[model samples]
Target: MKIDDNFYMKLAIDEAWKFQLLTYPNPAVGCVVVKAGKLLAIEAHKEAGLSHAEVNALKTAFLTQEPNSLLKVLEKSSEIHDFLIKNHNGFFEDCEIYTTLEPCNHHGKTPSCAKLLSILKPKRLIIGLIDTNKIASGGIKTLESENIDVTTKVLEKECENLLLPFKSWQNKTSIFFKMAQTLNGSIDGQISSQRAKLYVHTLRDKIDLLMIGGNSVRVDKPILDTRYVKGREPDVFIYSKNKAFSQAIPLFKVPNRKVIISDDLFKLLDYKFVMVEGVYTLLDILKDKLDFVVLIISPKIRNGVNSVNELNIDFEILHENYLGDEKIVFLKRRA
Candidate 1:
């Protein structure tokens, strides 16, 4: 495929999305540095307190220029900033960086990405969305003042979707309601593929909280941890009014995992990110509070039960992507 700015930005988004769960309390941002139509480096934020996407990309790209010599203290964000500023006099003068979110301008935990970019002097900075957080929003101005070209709102909607978790953490806790159903709308049995099931578990590793309905727990007696991905499991939030849950349930026996039983969804606001997996009644109860929905489309048509058929409200499909043999549709309320 012939490469263009759009293609590069799309690649950045793909890279960023992979780590959305991994970077808890931090936005999963991706960056790609292109020089003379050649890809210099591509990177995404893997976790908090580590090098951000832009800094990581710059570090990797810089290494290609100086492979024989080691740059000391470059892994830390502040050190990376100072190193790049001192070394990248004209190395990135004509290069362009495509990023999924605005470069940060604040100095906390690390040096400001905007300040580093200003010093490195990239030819252009293509941004998806301006940072809404007050602490990191003025990066565009800083870059512009340094005479670097800047572009905003490239793939804005998709970038907004990518930033949803981060924004939620800043304002209110983000809740994504997930449901797996057959093509004909049956979810009674396991219609979703094993891969899809594992994918859900992988997400479980990164989230702060998991909210499951009482009925599903009673009937399924499931363990909703992130064992499949070998990552840290999230705290469990049970949405049952009654405290008479089963002691035999594996979820209750998990060591060191905090399990809170309550019907009030208000408690979730205190969390950064929360995942809810339930059928219609659960969805209806959280209809007004939900920020996103994952409708797992299974190929099989079982007749046991279905969550989509039970949905009573209209939804807006934010984005749709396939996973394994299933189609993952991300949606929000039309209301």
Candidate 2:
């Protein structure tokens, strides 16, 4: 099968989606390195203050070309970048690089990716979306100046969609609703696969706060932490008019986590990234304020009460993929 630029770019986009929202305060990004139409490395930015997608891809590519090189064991972004710059040995000189976002031109936590690419002298650089950030926007120009063949806007819309959460949080609070339902649309019981549930746990690990209806807390009596992923626990905000609840609720008992109970929704605005896990009641109330919705739909159909009949809403599907037998969808409310 002959692979085109779109094929590689799409792969990069999908790889980035795996780490979506997990890279809070940092745009989730993916990169692919291809030399002579042979596969090399596909990597994504996994977290804030970590090696970027480009660096990770290039490092992996270098190792593929020079297996015995001393690139291993270097975990920090700066360390990997420095090692690659010193020992690249023209490994990427004939390669084509695909990235979902433009390389950063300005140095922040990590060194300038554009500067490194210029030195590595990759034959061509394909970008899905230009960096909208003022500080990082000059990468294309930098690459062009270095005479590295550059292509832009490969799968532009899909790449742009990937950045929605990052952009929303940069300007204001980004509140996305998350819920799981069966094929029949029933919201009751556990509807997500273990993989789907793990995804939710990873999101919870990255978010600044997790909001849910007070009724959910009281009834489920759940331990709403990232225990499955062994990740950081997010603070919880319980939205309810009646703040009177038994102290025995599992969520309220989690150590080192603040469980805020209030009727005010404005408190959600205080956090940059917030995930709301609830059904019709909370969704209806938060419809106007939500930036997106994450639906985990199980493959099974059964007789049970569903949220579909409790509220009427239309959302445009932004992205969808499978987690085992479940179909996870990202949607935006239609205007």
Candidate 3:
């Protein structure tokens, strides 16, 4: 069946949600397959190095057909494309493939997904999104050459959501940072207990990763978990140059949290998934080669040292909220 723009939009939004699955250390990817007016399969890239969205969805569909069948699916499945070799029907005779991003065309760690799609020759290719990278881009162009029906732009906003990270990574940029502060521009005062815990929890839930310096961790000893939020939890990344924290620390007790130690401190800790958080130990990450977005929750009241100034980088105010005498200022690094 021919897929409509509305269908594409739904696919796009679903794809965006998939990208969110990879928090902190992973990239999100989501996919869905529909055939004969029934949702055949749905899957998302749950972890790094696992099969991608397309592969996972296809596998699920095949498994549902034969619960105990385990025929080398991806490799053998390539033959299904023969059905589309001619307009008459080789594969995808009446099937529809819907994905959040463009099908991959390159043969990287795995075979080219684009090539596999070409073989399946689905009745129609509905792309909710397009790949933005120079190398992996242009799956639509490749498929069009073979005369298979294709449609796009159904859920552009949703598709764009899934592509946000790749676009940011390819552009060598980060998301605009935001923060809340008091009327006087203070996140805290003489005592660290100034800002409301509810506001801090809100900030933690929206971010894919939460970052802080050794000083922040030492001073606040934050729990850094997102139990209060409705969504998945983000990974907590602590930047430290020395062995100031230990496994006995409360943060380390969390199941999936990671602490990035500097080379100077690597010998002191033996932990998996641990790496350097920023380019310099004491320097702010905004000043380094790593361009991931950061959101700082601070007070506008400058009664204490300014965290932005202490990092030694220029930042712009993105948002502001006032609570009585306190002012919350959201700031972002200049591109």
Candidate of highest lDDT: 2
Residues 73-126, candidate 3: write the lDDT tens digits: 433334422322322234245667777677877765545567767766777777
For all predictions, the C-alpha RMSD in Å is 2.9, 1.7, 9.8
**Residue range 1-335, candidate 2, lDDT tens digits:** 64799999988999998888778898989999998778799999999999999999998888887787778778899999899888888888889999999999999899999999999999999999999898777998999998999999999999989998888888899999998998878887767778988898988988989999888888898899998899888999999889898998888777889888998988888888999999888889999999889898998987776765557788888788788878888898889
After TM-score superposition, the amount by which residue 296's alpha carbon in candidate 3 deviates from its true location, in angstroms, is 14
lDDT of candidate model 2 versus the reference? 0.89
List the candidate 1 regions with Cα displacement exceeding 4 Å.
Answer: 1-4, 63-79, 308-310
lDDT of each: 0.83, 0.89, 0.53
lDDT of 1 by residue, 1-335 (tens): 95767788888888887676568778889999998667988899988899899999988887777875456445787777777787786999879899999999998778889998998888899998888888888999999999999999988888888887677666778888888888887778667778888889877876788999988899999888777787777889999999798789999887668998898878887787898988788888888888778888988867775544455688777656678778888776786
In TM-score terms, candidate 3 sits at 0.53
**What C-alpha root-mean-square deviation, in Å, does candidate 2 show against the real structure?**
1.7
Residue 326, model 1: Cα distance from true site in angstroms = 3.4
The list of candidate 3 runs beyond 4 A from truth reads: 1-12, 15-27, 71-91, 171-210, 213-215, 221-335
TM-scores of the candidates are 0.87, 0.94, 0.53
